[model samples]
Target: MQAAKKPVTFYLGEEVAMLKLQDLKAEAQSSWETLNLLDGTELTAEAFQVVMRKFGDLRHRSTWERICIQLEALWLLKGLENCDLIRTLAAPDTPIAQAYPAELLDAVLAHPSGLAQVKNGLQQLYSDPLTESDRICAMQFLKRISGYETIDLDLPEISLQAA
Candidate 1:
């Protein structure tokens, strides 16, 4: 696919640094292309290394935080109902929950331990149960519990899906 072209001019103090900006952009594009060529596992490992250095932590928490940040970006880009979707998945009484298969609903509903705990507890809950989108919702809910400031729930109404 052809990359979209837009005029990007960077102003540095008193001068327009067009040539330097072009060089930087070219370097970034080359790096991105190289990364895109890696297999999934290799890419994930590389990403973990990058995040470990970026956060200055070797713990899993930093990697999880970075994942949540990416998920939040995806939600915002897709115009998902961040607040309502999170609430619906967490609360069993919501109308959306009413549409879920009864057992699946019970298994996937948010618990204090979070979605990972709920998934781990169920042995037979993996047959077309939760969509990838659904998992994303559950993940955001889980993250919000521990890192409440990470996901911005107070976005303007235009970005939110109707409940």
Candidate 2:
């Protein structure tokens, strides 16, 4: 008689859950290429939304943010130029700010389309005369993404005469 087969075992431990989550994220990232290949025809807004929601749920926010930046870059390079899609992916109000990786943010800021979006978003944020805390956060965001460049502001100087 043949030896008894080993018993099959399955356990859903924390490590197992984390691994599953990573697999999901990887799948989501791979879907980008498929979506890009369709030339914006097959990847309907609803489908895209579902993918975004899945990415949003993953605890690894940085991975999702990097994927978004790469997707935006690919779209721009391929002449897709879909500002609405980029806007939706990089919306300031979304979890992007929390998940945004430094390298990805830098890459996005370097691209013309991404830079334009960032500038526009900053303008909108400052349009309402931001409070001190808000201003600090804006400054930090700019500095982090823009490589700590100095911005010049024009201010008039007053001259004093001695009697």
| Prediction 1 TM-score vs. true | 0.20
Candidate 1 lDDT, 92-156, residue by residue in tens:
33211222223223333422333333343221122222555554555454553455645433222
State which candidate has the highest lDDT.
Answer: 2
For every candidate in turn, the CA RMSD to the true structure comes to: 19.9, 14.4
Whole-structure CA lDDT of model 1: 0.36
lDDT of 2: 0.46
Q: How many angstroms is residue 105 displaced in model 1 relative to the true structure, after the best TM-score fit?
A: 22
Tell me, by TM-score, which candidate is best: 2
Models 1 onward score TM values of 0.20, 0.36
Superposition TM-score, candidate 2 onto the true structure: 0.36
The Cα local distance difference test for each model comes to 0.36, 0.46
